[model samples]
Target: MSRSHIRHELSKLESCLRKEIGELANKHQIKLESKQSSLCEIIEVLTQAKLCDEPLFCRLTKLDAAFCQLDIGLYGLCADCENEIEPERLAWDMLEQRCAECAENYEHQHRQELRLNH
Candidate 1:
């Protein structure tokens, strides 16, 4: 898909997620201060406050970062290798940061680290 199209999709998704979060925050009587807040700030506040579940917050965090990356012309590039990310992976999740090779290597290394720590 074109970058514009991808951005549009990401915007829609981010809006939806933000609305959901707003509703939950309202339910909990918490103010978002959205006008003054960045996505990272909002995430930090909500996370520290424990106002939302991990899964929801996690998704929003990814969306926020991905949206920012898009703005910076860095979207769809692997974070580690700086190569273009696979279409299949982006199709699965636009928030994906690592290409398949880097992802597999990261996982392998992480598992090794876990073993070492254990």
Candidate 2:
């Protein structure tokens, strides 16, 4: 696929995920602006850290990280491993970037660790 295609798809998926998260957050009494600010903060931090080649991942992760900041569903997931994150059990989150085993054992373990930490 073209880079634009990949980016477009990623954006679309990210938007959908954000909508879902927003609904859930709102239901739980969290404001959307708070979530947006949290996402912005994470993006700023990630940019400063100079991590990851894929900007789309960084963008999507920022959105998810906001959810994490809200103490909702940012479970520690091994993007390469596809492992069940220890909390909020997002088994249905089919768009997960990693499985448990593969994430823990990927060739770029060092990079993965850094990615997860960010």
Candidate 3:
């Protein structure tokens, strides 16, 4: 509920995500170097690994940005609506800064923008 508490939670989440990303990278490396698999299988494995890693990479970037925002005293506020994000939502995911309604609206608007761009 407090700013310090949120920062502590965010630090823990960042550490956990970093460890998981490292493990994924190591697993991907092992798959790449395994001679037991055929070339096609190796390619497929690497492709799948990339697919998995991309989202984790994105999350890591977001978490880092959130840390920066927190440092600047801007955490726990919705980016779209400038309202405080719910404590329960922040507890569920410290990386989330948007409250539920604003988040949903932002997602809808983002989808529309993507459709228009395409």
Put down candidate 1 lDDT per residue, 6-27, tens digits, no spaces.
Answer: 8999978877777777776777
Per-residue CA lDDT of model 3 for 1-118, tens digit only, reads 6778877887777667656655665866643433344324433554566653477666665676687778898888888788899989977877886899999998999899999999
In model 2, what lDDT does residue 48 have?
A: 56
Q: Kindly give the stretch of ten consecutive residues in candidate 1 with the minimal lDDT sum.
A: 30-39
Candidate 2 lDDT for residue 12: 70
Candidate 3 — which pairs collide?
Answer: none
How many pairs of residues collide in model 1?
0
All candidates: TM-score: 0.75, 0.37, 0.66
Off by over 4 Å in 3: 30-53, 113-118
Reference-based lDDT, residue 43, model 3 = 37
Q: List pairs with backbone clashes in candidate 1.
A: none
lDDT of each: 0.84, 0.49, 0.70
- After TM-score superposition, what is the CA distance of residue 107 in candidate 1 from its true location, in Å? 3.0
Q: Cα lDDT for residue 60, model 2?
A: 59
- Predicted model with the maximum TM-score: 1
How much does candidate 3 score in TM-score?
A: 0.66
Listed per model in order, the count of residue pairs whose N, CA or C atoms clash below 3 Å is 0, 10, 0
